[model samples]
Target: MNRFEYADNKFSEIEMMIAIPSFIIGVGILSLPQALASATTAMDGVFSILIAGGIVTFITWAIAKFAASFPDTTFISYASLIVSKPVAILLTFLFAIVFFSITAYQVRKIADISKQYLFDQTPVEVISLTFFLVIIYAVSGSRVGIIRLNMMFFPFILFIAIIVVIFNLNWFKFSNFLPVFQSNINDYLTGVNKSLFSFGGFGILWFYMAYVNKPNKAPKMAALGTGFPIALYALIFLACIGVYGESVTASMLYPTVELAKMVEIPGGILERFESIFFVIWIMAIFNTTAMAFDITVLAINLVFHHIPKIKIIFLLSPLIYAIAMYPQNLIEVSAFETFLNYAVFYYSIFVLVLLFVVAKIRGVKPSE
Candidate 1:
């Protein structure tokens, strides 16, 4: 691909497939096992994980098909058709807030995790500011460039994750998962709600689906993209419990990183395996942060057609950093996450459902 092609388009289904999981496997997975572990009994979290994954995967497919119905159309263009221009613009602005909030949440969470595992001396404010600046730089360029970065970084992230799970095999204790299917309705429901939020980023397809060249191919590819992260999450969740019983997994802040610390190579050449893991892990989180912020900028640019993307980046940079640093402590950060998750979780379902309902009411359907 030449520079023009790279800059102007990435309408391939394959690219969309790669982009979904690359964006979804950010800071959420680090704390997933801990969150799930706390919500259920032995091995019961798997049910929630699978149930939530299935739900997200199906919705991803439905959403892609919805967007693919209107070929070569941007989200706002079709939204304006279904709803009036004013309502669509208002929805776009609201979406900008949601994606911007995602950027802030990822920044803050990554900063907090890095302080605990990678940078003890560094202040979280410094870490968050630096991370957001890097994201700002990435978003300043082409959107295709951000997708290309995901393609490059995804392999290392997946490789490191698989290695971590594999090496921790010896620590696996089947007894840890023995008391299966014992949880009550309420326990399973709580786990389902949390896991559903963990699988949140597939909503990116609402915008990106408009880019797929082969509309017919998008729904399946979207489903495949979401499936990869679901499988990864389940494997890591099981591995964490197997290594540390549910009690221990729930007690720690980041059980996945703790799992990394237990990994040792044959030669002991690099004593700190987690340090390497940390480096690769940042790449994954960067993919998530960069994409969310880039889309935020894109949404704003869509509304303010006169303003260049660079200016939008500069304008939103401070606001992003301010939100990231607003959480004074981990408790506050958790509170912020809970708020953002619900906002994202319900907002995603709401948009898709609203589109479907209004479309049906008005007798609008996907073009053949």
Candidate 2:
């Protein structure tokens, strides 16, 4: 068998479909309304999401095509094939750091949200540690297990989103979305940049595409995976704008969660809908963090080659925890998240373009 080809039958294309959207719809959703509102006014924010999502879709397609051409080998492996080992190692290692930083962002953001909304009495460290422990357990298992978890939790996440939008319709005002494109060119650019982070999770495609059972259809599946989130995000952003108005949405901390709080069932049985929303939303975060955590370990193993994955998982947990705890307040967390958003956006484009150019120059091709 070729070094890059494996007969592992763990993940089907359907699971690939499940996994990508799960990663895309994570902690970012909570703040998307604010991010959008801050960038532009009214429905212009919705347009920003659509534009950003389209750009990310193209990026996903490029990554999918690149990965499928190299079958069963991740960026870490094939990058080394296309480029020199030292350069590949450096680039792949930087990608690993990007993924790890994402995991840490999720860890801290979820903990802060949970403490503010769910467990006010509990220490944030305790909450974050508990979440990290769950993530560690999930990633420590087979990669297929993480995909299965995504498949299981995605429906609840989707259902809650629909419910929030449905219940909040009473507050919707058509006038709120008026004056689209009123923002200056710079403002639209700012909004697009803000919206870019929401789509960053698609970068996982570079690593996960290697596991697809059918490589030929992988690009289509990858496109589908990314396309759905674009639609879903547009719907949620529109719902938030029509309900909250741009100014109010911008002022709010977590506009989507606030949208949930605005919901009222006819019977009033569910008092704290945002709390319920948070619970399901955490599953999305878990899917993202677990996969990224797994990829981080995979990248390290590619470099070290001899270290056991389990030991690497154990070793990296503390570093993740430390990073998770590093943000002392919401201000610091916001600053850290802003820096990461730019890093993810720029690095994804940089690495993809570099690998594609190098692969072409070197006439890199898969084994027959």
- lDDT, model 2, position 334: 93
lDDT of each: 0.88, 0.85
How well does each candidate superpose onto the true structure, as a TM-score? 0.96, 0.95
Clashes of 1: 0
For residue 302, what is the lDDT in candidate 1? 76
Predict model 2's lDDT versus the native. 0.85
lDDT (Cα) of model 1: 0.88
lDDT string for model 2 (244-332, tens) is 88899999898888898998777878777787888888888888889889888878887888999889999989999999899889999
**Candidate 2 TM-score, true structure as reference:** 0.95
lDDT of 1 by residue, 1-368 (tens): 32334635755788888898988898888998998999999889989999999999988888888888888777787888788788888877888999999999899999999999888999999998888889987888778888888888888999999999999998899999979999998989999899999888777887887777787898899899998889999999999999999999999889999999999876887668999899999999999999999889878877888998889899898998998889889899999899989988788778888888898899876555
Model 2, total clashes: 0
**For model 1, what is the alpha-carbon lDDT of residue 237?**
94
